[model samples]
Every structure is written in C-alpha cells, then in structure tokens.
Target: MASPARPEQNRVVGIALRLCAATCFSFMAASIKLGYRHGVSTPELGFYRFAFGLPPLILWIAWSRNWTAWRTARPLAHVRRAVIGLSTMLMGFSALAYLPLAESTTIGFAAPLFAVALSALVLKEPVGIHRWSAVAIGFAGVLIVMRPAGSQLPALGLALATGAAFGVGIVTITIRQIGRTEGTQTTVLWFTCLSVLALGTLLPVYGRAHDATTWAILFALGTAGGLGQLFLTSSLRYAPVSVVVPFDYFQLLWAVLLGWLIFADHAPATTWAGAAVIIASGLYTLYREHKLGRDRPKADAPL
Candidate 1:
C-alpha cells in the first residue's frame, strides 16, 4: 500500500492548490474584461461562464463516482441559490466591464464583511465584538476604496460591485442553510446546471456573432472559470479551511498585474491600501472563527 502523505505535505499541497484557484479566478476576471473590450455583452459572457463550467463539474461528479450527489431534497433552495448567485455573477461581470479590474476585485472582497452582518441579522448567529469590530474595519477599508467624496472610480461599477458583494453575503447564508441537509457537490452542481438553463434561455436575447478572436476569448473565459471552481473544491480536500482560505487574497495581486499589463488599467494607491486593510481584517475574522471552533471556508463560491 502507498504511504500516506504527511500533514505538512498536505498543507503545502492545499496552499498551492488554493493559490492556483485564485490565479485561475483572477485570469477569469481578466478574460471578462477582455471579452467586453472585444464587444461581448455581459449577459452573453454570463451565460457562457456557467454553460461552459457545467461540463467540468459533471465530469468531476462522474470521476468521483458520486452520482448520488445529484439527489437533493431542497429543490426550491437550489432555485434560490441559482437565481441569486447568477444575478450576482452578472453584477460582477458588469462591474468588470465598467471599473478597473483591481477595484472591482477589491470590492468583491467585501463579501465576507457583508456575511458578518448577514449572519448576525439573518442567521441569528451570535456575533461577538471581535468579529463585529472586524466587519467595521473591513467596511472602512471599502469606504477608503470607494472614496465617496472624491472617487475617480465609475459610480455605476462601484454600485454594481458592492451589490454583488451583498448578494454574495446573502448567498453565503443560503448556502449555510442548504448545507444543513445538502452536500457541497449537490449545491455546486445544481447551481451550475440551473444557471446554465436560466442563462441559456436568454441567449436568443443577448447572444450575437463574434469574430474568431472574441470567440477564443470567450472559450478561454469559460475554461478559466471551470478550472478555478475545480481547483477551489479540490484544495479543501487536502487542508483545513483556515489554512487554504488566506491564499485567496493572492487574487488581488493577480488582478493588479493583469489589469496593468493587459488593459493598461492601473489601480490607484488607495486600492492597495484599502485592500491591505480589508485583507487584514478578514484574516483576523477568520482567526476568530477558527479559535471559536468554526471552520467554514472564507471563499466558498468559485467566483
């Protein structure tokens, strides 16, 4: 029999996988921006993102021999997740189309902050001062990024990105509710399949012919999204949630680099500063959760 890997080896593998997942997601974000620059509509991009992602997930389910994962008692819950999550996806894509890559990305990081408040209010989860403080600090970072009085960021994009974050928060709670009776595979698979169906119906309304280059970009976008989701799911199999999730912030670095190099979009210093604060606060929040015996993954959604 093969020897089992050491705990340290598992941690290293998990961290690497998490970093790869972040890179893939960051690449997907860049692809969305590039697709828009190539004249693709947000709805079309949203449609393809889920449609192409479905195959990989189906293959994964087959490979795992977990066909039972397709069974779910909570069809309505899946519907709610799919509808809300896809709406958030479109909002994020629109934000990418309108805002600098880094800014849109940074705003998305506020999901956990929103989750903190949502947990307290919606879930009736007790929130001590530590997490509440972290949430306050995290929002302060968001405000810094927003720079409400003298902001150069596009107002529409900022609003959309913030809305996406709040949507993510709501989705997080719904996921928690679903988790009470459903497996992760079931939730993810159902969401993707349902989203593909919903977005597919809109294809006639939003789809248009594209040049070969744009078509290639769309394919790349979908591929990156699928690979990112797979990597994120695989990482948790090797390591604890706390150990892997911190690597998610690596997406910010990838976003800054890709934005600057590909789109000539530079993130201002405030973006970096605010991102630092947000990341720090999020880490502290995670640490508090870990210490309190809570082990939920920070970045649960693929996008």
Candidate 2:
C-alpha cells in the first residue's frame, strides 16, 4: 500500500468498518440482553465471548508474527485496562437484560463524558470552558435519564449502566497511558487474554451454566464486540481523531433503532430528552477541543 493510496483506502475501509462496528455493537447489546434472561452469569458469559473470539485473534497473531509487541513496558497497564474492561462488558450485558436497550445504551454512552474528565485529571491536560460546560450538561442529561425521584425508570439497570460507563471510561484513560508505548493490537490482545483469564476463574465458582441458545447469544456477543473494537481501532488509520472520534456517538442512534426494531426495547420520553442534552453538551466539548487545535494538550497530557 503506497502512502497516499493507503490513506485513501483506509478512509473508505474505516467508514465501512465503523458502520459495521456500530451494527455489531448494537447487536451485541441485544444479544447480551437476551442472554441474561436465560440465567447466564456475566462472568460465564464473558468466557464464552472471549474464548470463542480467541481463535481468530490467535490466528491473526500467528499470521502477523508480532509476538514481541505483547511484552511492552506497560503490561501492567494492560492488565488494569482488562480488569476495568471486563467490568464494563459485564455491566453492559447485565443492563441490557434488565433495561430497555435504548435506555441501557444511552446511559452507557456516558463513558465519553467520563473520558473528558479523566483526560483532564489523569492526563493533566487543560480543558477550555466550553468543554467544561459540555461535561456539566452531559451529567445533567444523565440525571434526567435516571429520573431518581421517579419510579418509572429501572434503577438497578441505570446503576449498572453508570458502573459500566465508569469502567469503560477508566479503560479508555488507561489505554491512553499504555497505548503511547505499546501498539494498539498488543494492548487489545493482552486485554483479551487478561479478561478471559479473570472471568474464567470467576465463572466456575459463581456462574450458572447456560443452555444452547444462551451459548449462541454469548458467541454473538463476543463476535460483535471483537469486530466493533476492530473497526473502531481501524478507523484511526484514516482520519485524525478529531474528525473520526465524534462519529462514535452514532452508536446511540444504532442502539435506539436496534432496540425498537429488534429487541422491542423502547426509550421513555425522559430518556430521549436527556440524550439530547448529553449529545448537545458533548458536541460543545468536541467543538472546544477542535478550536483549541493541535498545539493544545489533549485531555490526557503526560502526568
């Protein structure tokens, strides 16, 4: 692949893959939601996702012969990411089962907002005022979604989504820490290895064995998850983060549509209303970042 042509091809591929990732992620949300009703524990469900997904990854590694990337200095960072990543995955699965997909995914999208705050704290980066306001509005949106005083919302599911968002946010932050020194593939590979090991240990003791249908859903969960991450990562090769990053929010639309058309999960009026706030606020933050430009330190500056 020549340099100029490679970039052009990558852009086309990136868009296609991201669209695919969005679809896969939405389907995964639906699958995990359905799987939970079959009495499958989160840990066990994880094992199925990772274990089934492992062979393809293994084959990719063998073909590429990039074994040394796994031994980077930040292996421990990868471990931390995996732990948080696993929690995020499990909580998401749990939320899907208990809450409407629209609500579950809408709340889960809060991770990016958390990412903004985490970048400032852990990265010691400067945040402009506009982004700060976005963070505030996004949280308010979250509160609206939760509707704490009202009984109509599913409290447990919302809590799970919050936990998942935080976990994923931490994972994202930690990735920034480690990814600077390590290849993304190395980081992701170790994450999968650590997560599978962690969950495998937990499953035997506490996980309930699932039926065939449950297993199928679990496989879909793993496949969709792996593919989504792959697409998202591949997308960076095409455009700058500023251009491609915001496209991530498109997942919300996919989730809402999938919930209604596939899983029969519908968002409450409040959920949609709050989502608008979150989106509006989040976009403001991105716009701030864009204005700040290349010279401005990223949300995660070096500690």
Q: Using TM-score as the measure, which candidate wins? A: 1
Q: How much does candidate 1 score in TM-score?
A: 0.95
Model 2 poorest ten-residue lDDT run: 294-303
Per-model TM values vs. the true structure: 0.95, 0.87
lDDT tens digits by residue: candidate 2, 43-152: 77677777766665665455556666466776667777776777777777777767887777677767778988998998987876777778888999988888888547
Indicate which candidate wins on lDDT.
1
Model 2: residues with Cα > 4 Å off, grouped in runs: 1-10, 59-67, 207-209, 294-303
lDDT of 2 at 142: 87
Over 59-132, each residue of candidate 1 has an lDDT whose tens digit, in order, gives 76776767787789889989988888888888989999889889989989999889889999999998999999
The lDDT for every candidate, in the order shown, is 0.87, 0.71
